[model samples]
Structures are given as structure tokens and as C-alpha cells.
Target: MNTRVNETERKRIAAAISVWENEGGAPGQDSMHHQYGRRIEADHSWTIYHVFTGVPARFGGDAMTGLSRMDATSGMLRLNLRNAERRRERIELSSFRAVPELAECGS
Candidate 1:
């Protein structure tokens, strides 16, 4: 990927990690009780990938609020956002094979 895209993905991953680390506690800790309010669980490996490549990604049950990478390769990272209801369940890249479709012209 391009340098600019990679850099942006790196920043996104860094921000996500910062949120996760700053929250403190293990991966499934009760972030709500903490000072930060809610802790965003981040995958270390995935974060690293995003830092290197600018691949966009969205994992976890609640796709709306899941973590996203900036590039395609970064999406290969194995950090799962996980589902809110199903705490044990993790959203993997393989599961999301359908890419978004482009808008049609003058529909």
C-alpha cells in the first residue's frame, strides 16, 4: 500500500491500542467501572499489522462500533473486536468476505 495510507492506518491502530491499554486490566475487564468509562478491547497483532499496512478492517459483533484498520493487509491482523452480547465470540477477518459495493450511477 501507499505510504500515506499506511501512516493513517498506523495512527488508527495506535489510537485503538492507546484506548485499550489506558483502560487497564485484562482483555475482558469491566471498563465501565474504570475512570475512562468503557475500555476498547484491541488485538495487539492486528494493531501491529495496521501500523505497517493501511488496510481497512471492522471486527466484533457490533460492526458500527468495532475497530477498523486503514488498509487491506492490516485487516489480516487477528485482533477481534468481539460481539457485545456474545462476549466469548470474536469477529474474524475471514468471516467478513463480502466487500462493500459501490453506488450505481443514476440509479
Candidate 2:
């Protein structure tokens, strides 16, 4: 069952993930959306993890259009660092902006 998702759908799914994160997850319960993604070395990009499985999708980089399509099975996707540390500080998934670590480079 290989379902082909277009760029629009990928962005839509990404938006859903964003919304799920912004709402602070499910009511009266803690949501693990924080583990959804982290800001990569690039600006405005992130390696977004699967909403339920926490697996990394091909979608990453260039927040606007880099999101990859979703397949029916996870085997078709790629795996990234499950727990990427952010300059010794935990990255808040809700904010996909560049991490403070990058700021140090310019200083």
C-alpha cells in the first residue's frame, strides 16, 4: 500500500503537527510533541519526527517546502537522530527557530 502524497499534503501534515504542538497536546494529558523535531544547523528547517511513532520522516530542511511525503509503512522512510541534543540545551519543538547554539558562532 504505497500512497503517494503530494507536496501540498506534506505541508498539510506538517501544519497539523504544528497545530498539535501549539495546543500543548491533548487536554488533561501531557503530549510528547516536544520530541517532534529540532532545529537543524540550517535556518528555518527541522528534522520532524513522526507524530505517533517518533520516527524521522524524509521531510526535513527548508521548513516551507522540504517536508517529505508519508508512506503507508515506516520502512520506506529514513531514520535520524532520535534524541538530538541542542547545544547542551533541550530544543523546544514548538519553536522551530534556530537554536541559540548558532548565535555563538557569530559572536
- Superposed by TM-score, candidate 1 places the C-alpha of residue 48 at a distance from the truth, in angstroms, of 27
The TM-score values for the models, in the order shown, are 0.26, 0.22
Report residue 47 deviation for candidate 2 (angstroms).
23
lDDT of each: 0.37, 0.40
How many backbone clashes does every candidate have?
A: 10, 1
Model 2 gets an lDDT of: 0.40
TM-score of 1: 0.26
Checking candidate 1 for backbone clashes, the offending pairs are 54-70, 54-71, 55-70, 55-71, 55-72, 56-69, 56-70, 56-71, 57-69, 60-82
* Candidate 1, backbone clash total: 10
The 10 consecutive residues of candidate 2 with the worst lDDT sum are 71-80
Cα RMSD for predicted model 1: 18.1
Candidate 1: where is the Cα deviation over 4 Å? Answer: 28-107
lDDT of 1 by residue, 7-105 (tens): 999999998876564333243564322221122335422222222233323345322223333322233222423223233332333233333332232
Per-residue lDDT for 1-107 in model 2, tens only? 23456777888999988665432244332233234432222443334545556555444542222333232122222222233344224555323346566555546
